[model samples]
Target: MSEPKRMGRMGRRPGHGPGGGMMPGEKAKNFKGTVRKLIQYMGKYKIAILAVLTFAVASTAFGIAGPKILGQATTELFNGLVAKVSGTGEIDFGKIGRILLFLICVYAFSALCSFVQGWIMTGVTQKVCFRFREDISSKINRMPMKYFESRTVGEVLSRITNDVDTLGQGLNQSVTQLITSVATLIGILIMMLSISPVMTLIALVILPLSGILIGIVVKFSQKYFVAQQKYLGEINGQVEETFSGHNIVKAFNKEEDMLKEFHGTNDMLFQSAWKSQFLSGMMQPIMGFVGNLGYVAVAVAGGMLVVRGSIEVGEIQSFIQYVRQFTQPITQVAQVSNMLQSTAAAAERVFEFLGEEEEDLTAEHPVKLENMEGRVSFEHVQFGYRPDQVIIHDFNCQVKPGQTVAIVGPTGAGKTTMVKLLMRFYDVNQGSIQVDGHDLRDFNRSELRENFGMVLQDTWLFKGTIMENIRYGRLDATDEEVVAAAKAAHAHRFISTLPGGYEMELNEDASNVSQGQKQLLTIARAILADNPILILDEATSSVDTRTEERIQRAMNNLMKGRTSFVIAHRLSTIKDADVILVMKDGDIIEQGSHQELLAQHGFYAELYNSQFEAA
Candidate 1:
């Protein structure tokens, strides 16, 4: 959420990404620009948005105008009744019929305006929702590794679904009501002042009081809404945790602990939501009650004025309708402020995501990678995940094209960091990584990544058929090509025996499949990708001895004529490497062929002896 990083080196490094730790609530800066940026999303559908506004205004004018005509007709009907009862008695039929017709027409026009307003509101809402959903999804696609690292799955999903939903509902319901409220207030105020200045003044004396009360409530309500959003995010994070780690929870018999965590978050959300709603819900009825008091005052004053022949009976009736009209705006203004804040909060989150920084990859005039031969080198590289601890310090190594290199060491010895550097997930703090003769910084990020295939110690096979999972390796690959890769990875025979063969469905994370099979399927994916460089980070460490042989065979098939990096704790995988490097605390402690290092009886020799002796 910080500025799209200073590629020019202008400020302190952001903590989450590169330079340093970010400000605690650094995300709020992008929120600061939300309304402005959100307005930008409306550009594609501005015509629809404007249409909604136009219909809203027109509807209010017609709706408020109808009530005024109805008020006049009611006054005439009353006066006629009085004359008839006083024995001057003939009610005029023409006046009665004409007023009846006018009343019918007024109701008819109001219905028509309501329909038009509803249609435009629907269009506007759809357009806004579409824009928000599409933009958020696209941003997800463009976002980098660190964004996912920093936020939980639940928090991200909540913004995509819950926050956008809140914005949509609030916008659709409130906009039309706000327009009607404002227009009605204006029209009604004109009629009331025309009736009599003194009565109008008296009716409006309580109007400012309503505003003052609403403002006070509004100020406090925003704070509660902010708390509500925070708690909602917490609840989302917990729910995601429960689902993702459900197996672990049950395995450890920690279901009760998980339930307690969920309930705590749920209770927090409930309290926050209740407080916000309680204040917002007070607006309409409270304002209506005060407006009713003003109505009583107006009726008493107008009755005396009419008796004094200072105000007409019909005019006094019209003034009562105007007082009702004025009350509505006061109520609406209160409600609208809550919706506005809800919108602002949602916009803030959305804009913050849109503004988040990604690792700087050259976009214009990018270095093109063509037919990469995959000679990789690290030149005095210094890198660290934290400021206090440097992982890779002044490390240097090189692998020629079509060579197989193995990195072995204790845990946290920067074996995996080398592969990450080759992949450019994180840039080095000092020194350089180069492929062939070109510095990594010069390569287009996607172009550079496309050259390598990786198989981690922990295999990643999503819930899908084996064919679909392999097809993920290269999206444009043919079905026949997928089958060929599966055969190469030695996964085809077992897949053929399954009920649906390569079409078999997997359990969540492929839990139904053996860990070795999952690892092979991921290897099949890598084989299908057909890149010039391969990285195996403890790839066969999870498999059984027989499974490791099968994987070593598939890995051998994939590594032929390609540059490969193997980070293996099992000394067997490294024994056949072109060169083996033993690393410790992010620096190379020994480097040689396997036999050459064993003769020296150094760190690699000790590690090899310990494992082989254990066997």
Candidate 2:
């Protein structure tokens, strides 16, 4: 059977729409640090970035020059009309036509520059996102099992998908907008000042007021934006859990409870989302209002100067257009703070994951297993998932080469923990587990793991053909070898009966096959591996008695001349084991042959007899 998927904690939730922001309960504490690191990532594409900047500057310059040049046409038209009214000269239609053509060429050139900048920036954003995802994928392998144990698949997936997407969007849109806004603001200020310093002073009065207003709104909105992203991650995690475990939920009749929990998170997300959107949405209108006020003041003041013969009407027109252009960038600047807040929040989550403690892979003079005899020993081993509380304490065991040892116990006896420790999934807190006189820690982890084969109770099968799944045990195994292993494990009969035979494809979750069939495939995989050591955890518990008998016969053949550890809930299966170790509460309570333990009438005997009595 497929493994039961684990669930994670549900915190604040985000909106239902894709890419909607929801606030997290905790904000990213190191916002500046994340931003600095993001900047450093962008530094890798310096030449492309420089080209984008150059194009943006050119685009803005051409755009900014349009209104001022159009003002000159207005001035010429006004002068020509006055001359015609005075009967002193004819209106200069040729000059006006030339000015109109120049304006069209300038605007077209500006559009081309903007398009090139956007195209280049898109490439930059995609390349950077690619690098970020690559690093994250590599980092996942280096991380310890404890990291995955503490987090959920959904939470980790959210970081890789949603957070990386947020960062990419911020780079693509926010970065370029920031550059354009600042450049436009500065260039317009210079144009306005050059036209008339008095009108420029009037426009300057509104700048501080606008800044203060934006500051207040952005200050309140930043927290919500941060919360929005956090909630988004939580919502994603909850969705993943609920969907993966939908069958369990239905079996347990938890529909109402699940709905209630989802609604609670959804409501929290709504509250955060609306507030963030509302505040950010206010910037444009507020800036527009302030901008219009500045426009009126500049127009009225410029009109008085025009009447006093200090400035021309065309210059006033240009100054008013400059004032409008100036306020747009201010509005964009205000909106960018919200975008930056979201980016920083997403970056912090990703960076926090990337910065998690990786397993210590360092070994001084690492040993390699050559001609492995599979003589295993545990001497004074101690361990716990957490450091403050130890579970397995001072455990000791020894197994000779080619011996079949069975470990029997009730649930939570740390049976699986022992297997994990032997495979170096978790390092022991005290003493050592050794293979052939060398400490397991001293051996190179990959080489050490290669010596053991595992057939877990929860069989894992990826989306592939049956033949391909069997070949996973030995990547370079031939098609004939895979079929031979399947025959040895008694999986070939069932696989041949399927419509496509060995070439039958499994679904993503391998749900197309029955539970017993999946188990048989896993057995076939293990048989193909041909490792010196094997760990079988309830390998046949999911199959029928007849199938179990077949599997036991196959396992006996596979276990010949190999050290094997069998973990079983069914006491009858391990009756012929060389040694049967009975455990409880993380420590072994008894060890002997099956007949010897039965004679003692202790834990093993009681456990063994209970199965029979229940049957």
Candidate 3:
């Protein structure tokens, strides 16, 4: 079997490198820039973010005061016990009760603040995510067709779904955690310094060392995170391809091959994922160890101070709690680096798509199509899909108001490309196409496209009822008009036989109906559009002879007085055309009536004879 189509290089345009593998040492480039832009997206929600921050600070402050206040109760109980042991005083149960009640209130207030902060931030995160998705959706429409041609559907979809999700989760969880952690760190530090500056110094010294270690781990883990995201996109592309083309894979007995390829991609993703997680996982344990050492040092120093009566037992107790709280936030701060790395990687992909060059839709006083007569002309049209290599060079063609132009050629002979240019899907590199003597570039693209109707060999139908799918051609078309269009295209008979007729719902893939039925539905859609110019790209190629005859008759009626361009593979279909232009290697090698071409006995005659011989 032919080698499987190369799944292009991960994270780059296809066909550039030797083996389509990622370059070595490829980290998430320009991470800071990506992060800056991501922050800008959040800027719109500043008021909500400020409220979250206010609640977070309030919660952390209350929590920080609880440990110290609880220490006050400990001191009170200690003094009462000592006094009772000497038989000089009784325990003050009332004072102790009051302290306990106040502690309970402090903790309760902290909990409420935390909850409020979470609620506000969650809404903000979702809104930010919604805007990202909205912008990406709009960006997709603004992009030129070339962008979609280069990228897989899964790749683009992953940006909207997976990448956006990653950004949302990171912003929701990490941003709030970072804020709380920093706030807690500061509060703890102040409490520790007030109790014992020496102990605070001991705790502070360990932090720089922990920071150095965290930096080292993060340096290694970030590359893996970038690789993980890249491989995720690749795996998504693989799954999309395999599932969409499952029938072809089974017909060719390529299941094992597909599985092997999937496993290879899966393994790559697994390796990067675990490595990133493993390195990040190391942070907590390593910080815990350093924290234990700091704890021991502070404990030893505080004990000596207590024995010397330099500090109270209650202060030492509060200091130890502050030490633990401080270390935890440092650990959280370190983990935020990892979180930020993943966010940057995902955001970079999304921003890259949004930054793609869009087609220039701007026109100054653009010409509009009015009273269109369906006249089209190509004047020395030079064009190519790529600029370095021109495909259709110095081509010329013209047609009057009422004519059927048949384009026939072998595969890869630029028949489709020529029509695509006429539609302005791709502008010609070095020539002009005119509709009604007005340059195509002079008119608005939407207005230009509205005047032409197309039905291709590959029929596209969305997940909707048959009537709705036909109505897609003209959104405002009435139900009666849709039915009339379907009847005109000869689609009404078979559609009526279905259980719900025009109201039957199609699944996402539109697989409920047969291929011919789908083509007829598309034809009905074009019929409803009722444009002055029609494009039929192998409109009946996939149907059986009887269905082909019916479709051909419908097309003939549809093409009655309009200018139509028919690209056909079957020689028998276009025998009665007003003109047949035979194409070869992007140039029209022969042009005349079919009979005239047969009389010439050249490339056109040989192509016609081959079809007869094959039959």
Candidate 4:
């Protein structure tokens, strides 16, 4: 089946804290390094980012001018009141109206600038996210199978979904916030200094204290953020595994065990999340307290200066506003610092996935076989999933074109591993595998796989119609051809008996159809593929005896001239004129015709007799 479009919602959990855009405790292993790589990744959008920064600065600067200009109006009104009370002059209503109008225009201009920057930043962020998803999708196809085998589906999927989304949101918000916060800090400081130097110094003194507190909070909260992110993936994996195998879980009566495991992971996630969020949440209050302290100092110092006739009354009011503005940016910067840490953490995961070792599919000079005879050979082949543990040791085989080779063995006999090697999913650790005298490595992987058709034990039917699923085997095949193939695999009758015939839509897991029907569809798909080499691993194991008989005849017709490798446990079905390789452990102990191997009565006879006896 196709991969789930949007998997579990691990990020959005119950009891999540406010300002949930960032997980503060999640710090990157290499913050600066990750940032540098992210910067490089976004290099193509440099001009757009630059424009966003410029407009953000302009917006903040224009906004910063508002309070100072409003102070002028306050000063004029105060002077007019004084003059009016003395009966020397009346209030300058026209001048005051002009100042107020000017303040409105300044604020309006600031808002316009903010909108432009936000629009541009959003576009840039979306473009980067799109590119990340595209690159990751392409990367998955070229990566070795072992990489996926070593990790959970959710862990890998998290790179594309949660991590990319987090990076995009953090980039959009933090970049603008950082620029505006810094600009506001600088602009407010200049305005405050212009009004009164003593008050400005008093206000600036609180910055060091705020910085120290933020640093302390960040240091203590970082590990928890890391833990939270880790557990989030674990929780997602656990959920995916449990749900996918829910039938097995119930069959085994392990609901309590599953709940216990889930609760354990959920508790870890909750602990880390609460700790990190709580620590980061402390920043706003601590900065507010420091800011209020700065406000008190600025007010006292400004009042003393005003009494000494050093600063105007309106100027003190503006300085107090500036002190408030100053502290706000500091708080914003602290919040942005946490956002940056989260951004770094998410970006690091994306980069790590991108940097994984991809399979080199391209051969220096690829060999193209115009007429593939399907003459396959394995010479002293040796392989293992890992280098230290050799599973298939000293395998030697040769097959002429149009021969059917039945591989019979107990489980863990390296039967499937042989198929993997032949398909070049993993290269052999020693010796070589060849087709028509050319080493598998000499041909490009895509071209090599193009010549083979596979009907796996686990059938994969994506979310589509039965016709479309069968058509997946040969994308260019017509409807008539698909029908013919289905008939050949004895899938046409059952499909016609279904409600929608070939037009029925399969769900994500294709669970509407029976396991046997799914197997028939996959066989139909392989038949439609019509490749020169066929690999059928338990192709008829799912059907009943009657259906199996029909499918066996269809399979015989399908494998007539093609080189087929049939891996099965049902020895009764494969007692034909073909070579049989009997294996045990990891070695092929017997190789001959069915009768010859039975006459020898080695592992093959033992396995063959045991199956009928059990039945």
User: What lDDT does each candidate get?
Assistant: 0.77, 0.85, 0.84, 0.86
Q: Please give the lDDT score at residue 382 for candidate 4.
A: 90
Q: For residues 18-119, what per-residue lDDT tens digits would candidate 1 score against the true structure?
A: 212211122334443765676677677677767767776776766667656766666677777888999776667678678778877777777777787778
Misplaced by over 4 Å in model 4 are 1-24, 207-286
Per-residue lDDT over 207-307 for candidate 2, one digit per residue giving the tens place of the 0 to 100 score = 99988998899899988877777776677767767887899999999999999988888888889999999998998788888998998999899999988
* TM-score against truth, every candidate: 0.83, 0.88, 0.88, 0.90
TM-score of 1: 0.83
lDDT tens digits by residue: candidate 3, 390-473: 888877889988799999999988999998888777899988999899998988777777888998887788889999989988
Clashes of each: 6, 6, 0, 2
Best-fitting candidate, scored by TM-score: 4
Better candidate by lDDT, 1 or 4:
4
- The better-scoring model by TM-score among 1 and 2 is 2
Which residue pairs overlap in candidate 3's backbone? none
| Order of candidate numbers by lDDT, starting with the best | 4, 2, 3, 1
Model 4: residue 290 alpha-carbon error in angstroms: 3.7
Worst 10 residues of 4 by lDDT: 1-10
Better of 1 and 4 by TM-score: 4
Candidate 2: lDDT over CA atoms?
0.85
